[model samples]
Target chain A: MLKIEEYRQIIDEQIQMLGGMKRPEGLYDPVRYILSLGGKRLRPVLCLASASLFGEYSAALMPALGIEVFHNFTLLHDDIMDQSDVRRNHPTVHKKWDNNTAILSGDAMLIKAYELISKSPVGVLPQVLEVFNKTAIEVCEGQQFDMEFEKTSDVTEEGYLDMIRLKTAVLIGGSMKIGGILGGGSLRDCALLYKFGLDIGMAFQLQDDWLDVFGDQETFGKKIGSDILNNKKTFLLISALNRLEKASKKELLHWINRKEYEAHEKINAVTRLFQEAGVSEVLIQKRDDYFTRSLENLGKINGDHEMKQEIENFVHKLMARSR
Target chain B: MLKIEEYRQIIDEQIQMLGGMKRPEGLYDPVRYILSLGGKRLRPVLCLASASLFGEYSAALMPALGIEVFHNFTLLHDDIMDQSDVRRNHPTVHKKWDNNTAILSGDAMLIKAYELISKSPVGVLPQVLEVFNKTAIEVCEGQQFDMEFEKTSDVTEEGYLDMIRLKTAVLIGGSMKIGGILGGGSLRDCALLYKFGLDIGMAFQLQDDWLDVFGDQETFGKKIGSDILNNKKTFLLISALNRLEKASKKELLHWINRKEYEAHEKINAVTRLFQEAGVSEVLIQKRDDYFTRSLENLGKINGDHEMKQEIENFVHKLMARSR
Candidate 1:
């Protein structure tokens, strides 16, 4: 079993190599800056780990790095679209620079990702590129779905699930699947690993929804119930809207309708209503269900027992974390 | 060399194939709408011609289609960034749909370009991907430079040339080069073809600039002097600024500095001064220089005399056209 630290080092090194090129004066700097402001490297790590399940992880590092580049490229553009002020506790690329720079730099990042993937040895390049292309298209599909959700009403739970699956889960699933393919895993094993990642990603996102309202403020690394303040349509809120009695519905609408209510007070009232309506318990149950399904899928993959245990332990650690 | 109509048919067919996939609901329809509002398909034609100079023109159609997709992808996002209302006499994608949709759809177009390139046989995929990637990054870099120009007042003629080279010329050059490479041209021949396309692209853009200000109202196919009205820094305008005496400089500044003015009066006055100062003649000379240089490079390429003549005739026709 490979050490987590070893995987982390490979990702960082590959990132450095990918970025080390003759970029235009102002263009490449922003790309380097965004890559430098690193996150968990979760996607690439999954790629490496999945690859390691069948073959040398080192062989997968470049392709895994490609996934990382693609992920960051999406983030750079997403920040501009979302008008986000900060990312990873730093000013977003668009915030610090201008939107045009952000847009162009993000464009370069996508190109760079393809460049990295194209550098993979000839044998695996075609398969790696195919998976990469599909995942890339799916990510864009997810983004479009997300944008549509903003102007829409009556979004079904199924629709929301599909949206998140396309937007978030599929990339994670694809990353693992790419690793499996690159590592010479059987097609069935690759498919199973992909499913495992998808389920885990779904569970992870639901947990994120849970944390928005119910998480410990200190440990969660953000204020609790912030979603209610912003009128975000989380699973709990959507379920509560659907299931609440007439009186509770009216009360919930009042809080949502008010444009200038106190954030904390509105959140508190919304949390209370959500709890009373059993939305919180329902979301928790759904999260647990997906998490269990993810574990089941993971259990079915035929890999070294020791490697499997290591991956399971890592995933457990991820699930147990508060933030 | 192939007949122009033959090249056009191949390009049209390839474009149809590239755009054949069903766009997920609410996502990419507007992008498809904008792309379907066709233009002259000149870039792809050049690509096919350049390739046909060495081998079968049909071999270059998919690669040429890749360039077209990449070009449209840039247009989709650039429309959003520039807040453009119309493109090709139709509503820009962002205007027709929304900014987010345009952004995502443009992204999908970019990914689709990769998908198309990856479809090339394994023997050529790596080189095709490499050139494609480099060209893509350069396009973004050029766009970034253009954006930077908007905020800065000290843009030089050299700087403007460099920006347009990235933004416009490299893609055209790369399209031809990719075609040449895929058509089994030697590396040296591919390099010469790229130079030829690049020089021709520069001349093409210079002509575009000239037409923006001085083109006949009916023949130009767009609003005359629109660049002046929007204060765009074109080669003639920049040269006028550089060469103007004190009085002319002040007059030019007045027109540029004014927040609002009669469109006709301002355009007429600016065009008059541009001509009086010989900026137009200088620009025309520069444009011709590029055209001559492009032909010179084309002459250096080792190919059949008849094939070379066919391509030369096509270039002449392109240069001679009004719109």
Candidate 2:
């Protein structure tokens, strides 16, 4: 059975092999630029890995590329919407070029994604497109909810979970399902895979919230407590808001409402309040619960035993990352 | 035997029937808002007409909606890029909602277009997607070139024509081709339909340039000579720049280079130069040539006689429109 690293390597190679987007330097250059900025390639890797579990993984390559391209297209436009200047330690497309370039290039990348995904075998093309289109629209809705939550002071944990489910988890789930379908997995097996992926995605996002506060900055690849600094509604913040006592809640709200404050001081204050509210422990428990549920789904899938073990090992490694 | 007006009415009915995009009002509302701001429905009407020429027009309805939705998607984003406030006598999406709303909603609209197009029967789905994807990418390239041309001088007529073909004509051509494919037209017939649509598209855009200067304000539905005021590069402007005498060329150049000039004076001066160089006659002749070529392609189609005549009459009605 192929390991997770092997799948990721395949994805990287396939992504690099993408070419023939030559003309209109103004349009294609940003696409190439964004794709070149390396990330974990989690979605495509999961797709290829899931495909390998049932049959040949190679058929999943084009669809996997489609998922990754769609992901990056969202990022390019999101950066402009968020007014974010830096991404992966480099200037964003909008900042490096201009807003119009980002918008137009992002649009082209989206069309490119559709073209790639349409390469799926004709027999399963309709089903593949169905999953992709639903995921795509959900991703946009997730973004809308995320933006709305920024202004709405009374965001619920349920609402946050639903938002992340739409924004982040559905695409992850859909990617695995698409791979499974292309891999000749049975409908029952595909459904199991989708559930597995959804649970894992939820855990993955919860872990992201955890890492923003508890993990080391070098390991997290982002500044600790940056979410708090932005007053970004995360799992931890929502949980904290629910669990905090009146006095502590007042203090937390004061910090959140503050227009200006020293960075370290605010981070320190929020971190302390979160611990006092005991939401850190609650978040850890919830993340582990989701991880366990994901394993349950994965274990139930009637695929090759070695392949199942490989997937299990991969998720264990993902969950075990600490720092 | 259905006339163009009947095709248009069918398009209007189908467009009105679009529903089930309920949640995330922040996102879907703008989509509904923009679609409500109607236009000629020319693309969809053309698709339906071409489909009727070969076989069942009903089979083409979904794909026709796909074309129109895709067209509107481009317009939504274009309004943002152009910073235009008004469209179809109402505030544009960006102006009415916001840029982020327009951007995200426009993205969803693009996905909706794909979903609608994907409803094409399994036999023709792949071909339909092929045409749509190629056209979508070309449209973006066209927009990029259009933006580039704004900052560029000495843009040749040939280059300008290529840009418009990408930006405008290909979608028109693709729409017809998709309709033909869905309508069970032969490959040769579909190819001819594409050519017909392409030629008509070119003529339609050139007529737009003509009407901007020569069109009556009330009848044209836009300010006369607004393109001149904006220093837009049209066939007349480019032709006059090429054909004018030395003294007249300098005068034209003076107006073109001037950062500040009376709008009416500039419009009058440029209008005079265009007439003097006889480029108005040249443009009219070129537009007529395209119309003639379009008729040649339509005449070659081995489809229903009345359908062909209907298409011919439709283009005639289009070309004959003047202020």
lDDT per residue for candidate 2 within B133-161, as digits (tens), equals 99999999999999998888778888888
* TM-score leader: 2
Q: Model 1 shows how many backbone clashes?
A: 0
* Interface quality of candidate 2 as DockQ: 0.87
Best-fitting candidate, scored by DockQ: 2
**Shift in Å, residue A151, candidate 1:** 2.4
Q: For residues A1-323, could you state the per-residue lDDT of candidate 1 as single tens digits?
A: 35665788778876776666664657888888889887889898988889888887777777788889999999998887777888888999988888767877788889888887787778878888888899899888877777666656576677778878888898999999988988888989999989999988888888889888888788888778878887777788778888899999899989988988777889889999998899878888888898899889889998767777777888878777684
Residue A312 local lDDT, model 2: 88
The fraction of reference A/B contacts recovered in model 1 reads 0.74
Clashing pairs in 2: A216-A323
TM-score of chain A of 1: 0.95
**TM-scores computed on chain B for all candidates:** 0.95, 0.96
TM-score of chain B of 2: 0.96
Candidate 1 lDDT tens digits, B1-323:
35766887777766665555764756667656766888878788877777777788776776678788889999888887888999988889878777767777788888988887787678887888888888888888888788778777688888888999999999889988888888889999999989998998899888989989978778677889899999898998888888889899889989999988899999999999898789888888989999999999999998757767877887787777664
Show how many residue pairs clash in every candidate, following the order shown. Answer: 0, 1
* Runs with alpha carbons beyond 4 Å of true place in candidate 2: none
lDDT (CA) per prediction? 0.83, 0.90
